[model samples]
Each structure stands twice: as C-alpha cells, then as structure tokens.
Target: MSGRIVVGVDGSEPALKALKWAAAQAALTGDSLEVVTSWEYPASWSTMMPGVPTEFDPEQLAKEILNASLEKALDPATAAAARRTVVGGNPAQALVDTAKGATLLVVGDRGYSGFKAAVLGSVSTNVTQHAPCPVVVVRGESAAS
Candidate 1:
C-alpha cells in the first residue's frame, strides 16, 4: 500500500498467475510493481557429466524467463511499466532480499504435495516466513491459457 509490490516469477504456470495478480494489485493500490527472477548454479555443476554443455548461462536464462513471463502475464503497457530484476542466489532468499522495502511480496503456490513440500521446502512458504513485508501466495492457473 505504502510501498512497492514485489513479485517472484520462475516461468511456471502458477508463477505467471502470481505475476498477473500482483500487477492487478499494484494497479488498484497505485503502487509500483517489481518483478523478480533468480538463478543459481547447481551443486553438482562442478562434477557434471562430460557431455553436458558448458555454454549454459543461468543469468541469461533467468532474464529470458523474466521477460517472457512479464509479456505473458500482463498487457504490453503494464509489462513495460513493471520493473524487472534478475538475481543470483536461492529463489526464496533473492525474493526476500529484493522485497526488503516493499509493501507486499507476492509468489505462486508451486503445487508441491504436502509430503513433497515438507521434504523439498516451498519458496512461497519460506518467503512468507522470512520476507520483511506482507506476503501473498497466489494459487491459480495461468491466464495465458
């Protein structure tokens, strides 16, 4: 309400929905929207198979995902108005850090089953507990389809 709204997107269906929801909220509240995506190298990257391509750029991939998500989630004007950020770190932590001064932090429900979620941990759950601002876990289908 008083500050910007931050949303985390990962190019997933639910993440696209979250972006749409956050954009709508930002419009209603007259707040700026900041869209964020993060990338991190895998733990096994240093010991990967020989056939694996070494040309993969996680940061570039993240940027592409963010741009594509914005285009898919919002209208051209809205997408242009929204701020885009690509970070390098854990998804949940990157979101929390970027949302430090935000009025709200929005994320999607990845739809991980209860048992799987407990074992793997959910980014939405982690950010809801750790973010400095109020968090919204948008749960729904993608608007694109």
Candidate 2:
C-alpha cells in the first residue's frame, strides 16, 4: 500500500478534522491526498412545501459540500493540493471503493447531526470494518465533555 492517502468528508467538524489530518499525513509521507464525498438520489419525491428546497442535484451538491469542507477545514494551500472526488453512491461504499488502492483511509468517527446514537452504523464504522486499506477515524470531543 502506501500509495495514496484517502479521506472521506461530509463537511462535519469531525470530518473536517480528518481531512486536515489526512492532508498533513500525506505531506509527511509524500503520498498523494484524495478527498472523497458521496451523494445519493433523494429517497423521496413527495411534493415539497413552499419553504422546502426541492431542486435536486446530487452531484453538484456533493461537489459543493466537499469543496466547502476542504476550504473550511484545511489551509488554502493544503486544500488546493488535495484532490477531490464527488461520487454518487453510499458514502461508506464510495469511500471504500475509492480507497481500494490507497495506503490509508481516513474518516470521521462521527457524522450527520440528525441522530443522537447513529454513530455505530455510520460511514466511519463501515469503512473501518470494510476498507481495503488501514483506516484512521478522527472524532471530535463531545460538547458536553
């Protein structure tokens, strides 16, 4: 392995931390850095309420989120140096597939703010269990701590 350093980001604080850490690691190891983000088609096509946003563009949204994550998390030079990929699929699967030939796969220990106890089945967990390369998970401190 030790080819590329792959990181999965979804714009969360923990994810941003992972991205920054991965970029640093890549610089130290002289490995290429690849940041990945995944998106899926909307699950529901139900009529949208007036205030709800219904214009769906999964690819575009994924790219924006990924870029924003990098820009917000890493220094400008670091963010610009890291290659980004926005793919359409399950986040876990996409990350795993993208990191297939990578030396290390990095992801956040936490994700989506929608649920309180959804950490176990998240992208980090899935990638840790199934990624072809070694995985590193970065977790943010609890707010209550």
User: Highest TM-score: which candidate?
Assistant: 2
Model 2, position 72, has a per-residue lDDT of: 90
Model 1: how far residue 19 lies from native, Å: 0.3
What residue runs in model 2 are displaced by over 4 Å at the alpha carbon?
A: 47-54, 118-121
Question: Number of clashing pairs, model 2?
Answer: 0
What C-alpha root-mean-square deviation, in Å, does candidate 2 show against the real structure?
2.4
Task: Mark the 10 consecutive residues where model 2 has the least summed lDDT.
Answer: 44-53
Pairs that collide in candidate 1 are: none
Query: For each candidate, how many residue pairs have backbone atoms clashing (under 3 Å)?
Result: 0, 0
Query: What is candidate 2's CA lDDT for residue 116?
Result: 59
Top lDDT model: 1
Write one digit per residue (lDDT tens) for candidate 1, span 22-78. 999999999999999999987888586456678978899899999999998899999
User: Which regions of candidate 1 fall more than 4 Å away from where they truly are?
Assistant: 46-50, 111-121, 141-145
**By TM-score, how accurate is candidate 2?**
0.87
lDDT of each: 0.87, 0.84
Provide the global lDDT of candidate 1 against the true structure: 0.87
